[model samples]
Target: MQFICLIYNAEDNGPQPGTDEFGPYMQAYADYTQEVQDAGVMVGGEALQPIATATTVSVRDGKTELMDGPFAETKEQLGGYYILDCKDLDEALKYAAKIPDAKYGRVEVRPVMVFD
Candidate 1:
């Protein structure tokens, strides 16, 4: 089974701290990535640009509507994601908990739906 771990955090919190604070965060992630990679669980992952750079689109009445920013406004914004191959939801949850954001924000672990 595969799952996507969606990382979310507050945009108002501003850019993550510089080298001082960021160093620990990066080290934590590096450790987690290495552990998962060693276990053959990590498939892929990436960090996303800020929400301010996002564009939203919707279609209604046969017309396409384009709007600036994310689909919704919230204190927490989707910041990145990790796609993992896991034995099950429980295993995925364990991995999600290791994400640094899980301490201050949220890491939503959702299974991927595959179409036959």
Candidate 2:
């Protein structure tokens, strides 16, 4: 089974880039990536830029509407995601726990869908 671990956390509360702690924070993620790759479960993953860079698109009445930033304001924003190949949801969740962000943020584990 394949699943995606969606990481969410406060937008402006994380360590600022170029700050002293930022390097270690990024290193922890790198370590986690390496570990998962070594275990042959890592399919793909990446961190996203802030919501400020996002554009929400919607179609209503056959007209396109573009909105800047995310659609709704929330305490936590989608920070990143990791796709994994696991035997079951339980196994995928275990990897989600290993993510450093899980300490302070929330990780939503969802299964992937395939259609023939």
lDDT of 1 by residue, 1-116 (tens): 98999999895553276647778887888988899899999999988998889999999999999999999788899999999999999999998999888888899999999788
- Model 1 per-residue lDDT at 45: 94
lDDT of 2 by residue, 1-116 (tens): 89999999997676768899889988999999999999999999999998999999999999999999888788999989999999999999999999988987899999999676
- All candidates' TM-scores? 0.90, 0.94
Query: Which parts of model 2 are misplaced by more than 4 Å?
Result: none
Clashing pairs in 2: none
Q: Identify the leading candidate in terms of TM-score.
A: 2
Best by lDDT: 2
List the pairs of residues colliding in candidate 1.
none
Q: Give the backbone clash total of model 1.
A: 0
Which TM-score value belongs to model 2? 0.94
